[model samples]
Target: MVETKLLMIDDEESFLATMEKRLSFRDIVVNSSSSGPEGLKILDENPDMDVVLLDVKMPEMDGIEVLRRIKAAHPLVEVIMLT
Candidate 1:
């Protein structure tokens, strides 16, 4: 089976770092962003990522708003919300 690519977005840098390390161990191409803008950029750059793990609370742009844009921009990808 092919390893799926993933993106995890959160405002807390420490949390994103930890999750990145953990997910990478499973041979998945895991990328995490510490802000909504950065996450959007990642989504634009890697249009083929399989799933996105998103947090509901954020500063500049809330996860819900980010998720909305992400879905609008890339409807094919899967999204999992974490609060």
Candidate 2:
């Protein structure tokens, strides 16, 4: 009965909000960010995060770059890329 800790990174605010709501209902603890930098910051702050739902295309920093950074720093964290 352990709750999943998910970090969602997407440029679409609406999508993040909707996913957060739906996932919360399922007992997930969701932390959302609209940009790569912010998402990285969240990851730094929440070292216990289990998974990341990352959007492939975003401004400020692209998902690929974010993925690279995440893997470099938080290699144990799993990332699922979203189109």
Candidate 3:
């Protein structure tokens, strides 16, 4: 089976940690960032990443704007927004 690479972006540290742990247990490769800008940077660094689990409400940069930027730059990557 092919491994799924996922990038999780959320401002909540606990949520990120818990989800990363759970996802990692399922054979998913998980990468995470606590801010939108950092998450975008991570995406830039990891172009082969498959999907992004993004938080809708975040400081410094909101999910909508991040989604716009993501689509503008890397249209092929899939993003799932969470509130």
Among these predictions, the greatest TM-score belongs to 2
Cα TM-score of candidate 2: 0.97
Residues 32-64 of candidate 2: C-alpha lDDT, one tens digit per residue: 999999999999999899999999999999999
Of candidates 3 and 2, the better by TM-score: 2
Pick by lDDT: 1 or 3, better one = 3
- lDDT of prediction 3: 0.94
lDDT value, candidate 1, whole model: 0.92
Local distance difference test, candidate 2? 0.96
Candidate 3 local lDDT, 13-44, one digit each (tens): 99999998888878699999999999999999
The whole-model lDDT of each prediction reads: 0.92, 0.96, 0.94
Flag clash pairs in model 2.
none
Deviation of model 3 at 12, angstroms? 0.3
Q: For residues 1-83, write the lDDT of model 1, one tens digit per residue.
A: 69999999999888988888888779799889988899999999999999999999999999999999999999999999989
Per-residue error for 33 in candidate 3, Å, reads: 0.2
Q: What is the TM-score of each candidate against the true structure?
A: 0.93, 0.97, 0.96
lDDT of 2 at 41: 99
Give the distance in Å from residue 72's predicted Cα in candidate 2 to where it truly belongs. Answer: 0.4
Which 10 successive residues of model 1 have the least lDDT summed? 18-27
The runs of at least 3 residues in candidate 3 whose Cα sits more than 4 Å from the true structure, single-residue gaps closed, are none
